[model samples]
Each structure stands twice: as structure tokens, then as C-alpha cells.
Target: MSPERFARINQMLDNRQIDLTVCLDKVHKTNNIAAVIRSADCVGIHQIHAVWPDIDMRVSGNTASGSQQWVKTIKHYRFEEAEQAFNAQNMQILTTTFSDTAVDYRDIDYTKPTAIVMGNERDGTSPEAIAAASQHILIPMIGMVQSLNVSVAAALVMYEAQRQRQLANMYGTRKLDHAYCQTMLFEQGHPVYAKACRRKQIPYPSIDEQGQIVASTEWWQRMRAPDPQALTC
Candidate 1:
């Protein structure tokens, strides 16, 4: 990897938010999904959770403009599953919806570990998602249209979270754990070799000062060796 590339990757990982995340509940539109991913990446969110029944949760590359590649997306078959996963991480779920009880999006304390949940474009947030949410939030609208598009709504709320986090200096320093930083750096810088190591069930080779793989000669030789299982076949 080039020094420039390594430096960029390291810088991004260093500012990544480990606590903040986004969740989509039954949002099937690929374009909207991609837009949300783009916004999430801009705010240094490292992961996004998506729960959809039938549609594949893959982001549209064209719409995402390569932003999807920078963020990890976890898809769940059910909203319950997604809720439980985030809950386990101690993240408070805040679903965006129109409700009498819902509070203004800006009123919430976003500096805490939080996951902003967005719903389907047509049907709005799922009942299960609403029920599971610790708090309900909504963007104020004065026009005839009651709600904004899913992606736009997500971007609005996410940026609010980013703003609050920034005020708290969350983006001013390294927030990622040491091990995660190294792992992401290696994967981003040497994707081919990272995949090779995964396939061969071997640990990743150490990266040198210039971001070049150390002991490349020995590692490549081992990687090229035929597998014993394949030999039996």
C-alpha cells in the first residue's frame, strides 16, 4: 500500500465513531439505502444495521458512490433481531416516526451511545421497531408533506448526532479501539492479502512502517502452497 493510502485509512479509522450507528427497518429502496450509507460515512459512522424481509440489503454502488465500501452493514431478517443486537451493545434505539409522543429530533441527547432508526419509505417505521425503540423522534415539518424521504430524514438526524458528538469532541480524537484500528487498516490497505489470509485460515502478516507487508516473501510462498484437503480431492 502507498503511504498516502495508509495515512488516509488510518485517519478515517481514528475518527470513526464506535457508539453511533444507523438502522433501517424494512426499507427496501436501494437508492435510499445507498444515500443513508453515504451520510453515515460522512459522519464517521462505521456500521449500519438494516432489517428487511425479502429484499437483499445490499447497497446500490452507483447511488452510494463507493461510500458503502467504507462502512460495514449488518442485515437482519427481522426487526426483533436487529433490536436485540443493538441493545446488547448498550445502544439506545431512537426510531424516527410521526407520533404525538414523539419528541423533536434535536431534543434527544445524541452524545450517548445511540442508534437512529429509519423506516420504510411508504409504510413508515414498523410497529415492532416503534415498540422496541427506547424513544421516538421526528423532524418537524411545516409544509403539506407530512414526512421527508427516508434517506433525507436519516441524513438530517445523523448530522444532528454528529453535531452533538462534535461538540463533545468525539470527532477530534481517536475513538476506535486499538485492535479494530489495526484490523481495518490492514483490510483497507491490503484487501487481496486480507482475503487470502481469511481463506487460508492464517493470521494477517504484519504491516511495515511504509504500509508494505512485512515478510511478504515467506507469506506469499505459504499462501501459494496447495491445501492438504484439496490434494486429497
Candidate 2:
């Protein structure tokens, strides 16, 4: 598939049907953060919650190719806020760390709502984040190094999620809410695709139709018809 095709599919996934998040905790390196964002998008994750004290955005902006615009990034300054948000949603917070209770990273189930947290490159997950996590994961290794960089570790974990959820055919036909999807694609300036979507009864998106970056399902509904066969016949 071409880059444009990939971008379209990514926009589709951002409709929030994927149910996974990647968050960084006060990570110092911008290149690594940028790479993490890139990796998250590469693997079909379109929402990222990042918590960093001071970020050198040049690193992320350089690699993102405006890819971040296609994704929703909620920035946080405190671990408590990040923890409270994901935890309240019952999202399984899995952190990469080599602690006594840490399990092999491959053991965790990624099919459920999940948030993978990566901590400071030098310090690993903060004590607070580790405590808040539902489980601690470690990438097992037989090599000379015991740990990988923060960004590399995140890539490995998220791909593991893709492997499990995908091998099970978890997302192929997963349909998001019809209305929410249309608004998203429409706002993406995909009027043609939006018409196709409404004609097919696909989900309408929830984007703010009048906002700066806008997409509206109402436009599609105005031009398209509900499936006739879906009616009482």
C-alpha cells in the first residue's frame, strides 16, 4: 500500500475503536519521544497520552511529518493526572520495568483496553507510575544489554499488542459507531469518501463540525440514503 493509503487507514483507526494508548512519563529525549510517536502511528495506534516535564519539540516535529495531527495527543505534566485518567477508564496500565514482580512482557493480554507506559530513559518508569500500573512488563533478553531505549521498548510492546489482537482477527471488521466515523472522515476533507461511507451506513464521526479542523456527518446524510434493504420489506 502507498503512504496515502496508510494515512487514510490511520485516520479511520483514530475513530477510537482501537482502544489503546501509549504514554511517556517525563522522558527527556525529544528524538526518542518523536520516534515513539512515529512508532505508535506506524502500528495503527492513533492516540497518545504523553507526560513530560520539558520537551524539545524539534525532535518530534522533525520525524512526525505532521503525523501527530492525524492523532490525538493529550499532554500531561503530572503522573497522577495520567494515572487517574487511564486508571479510571479501567484501562490496563502496563509498564516496562525489570522489577521482582515483573512478568515477561509477552504474557500480558493486549486485546483488552490497554495503555502502555514508558518512563524516563535514564530512570525507567517512575515509582509512582510503576505503583499505578496494573502490571509490570519486562522485555526478556539473552543479549549483553538488559534493557533497550525507552522508545525501542515502547515499539516492541505495542507491536506485541498488534500481534495478539491481529492474529486473533480482532480488528479487521470491527465497526465503530456509524455516526462518529462519518464526522471524522468528513473533517479530514474526505467528502467523497464520506459520501461513500454514508451510502454504506458506516459510522459518522464525532468531530466538531464547525471547528478549525472540522468533519461533519450531517453533510453526508443529506446527500446519501439509508440502506433500503435495511428497512422492513
Q: What TM-score would every model get versus the actual structure?
A: 0.88, 0.71
The regions of model 1 sitting more than 4 angstroms off are 195-202, 223-233
lDDT per residue, candidate 2, 22-117, as tens digits? 888888787887888787777777578878655433346886666675566778878888888897778999987888989988999998889998
Whole-model Cα lDDT per candidate?
0.87, 0.73
Tell me the spans in candidate 2 whose CA falls farther than 4 Å from its real position.
1-11, 14-17, 54-59, 173-183, 190-233
Error of 1 at 202 (Å): 5.0
**Model 2 CA RMSD to the hidden true structure, in angstroms:** 10.5
Write down the RMSD of all candidates, one decimal each.
Answer: 2.8, 10.5
Tens digits of per-residue lDDT, candidate 1, 1-233, equal 88899989878887789889999988888899999999999999989999978754567889999888788888888999998888888999999888878999999999899989999988999999899889999999899999999999999999999999889888857877777766777788999878878877878877766787776677789888886557888
| Ten-residue stretch with the least lDDT total in model 1 | 52-61
Worst 10 residues of 2 by lDDT: 206-215
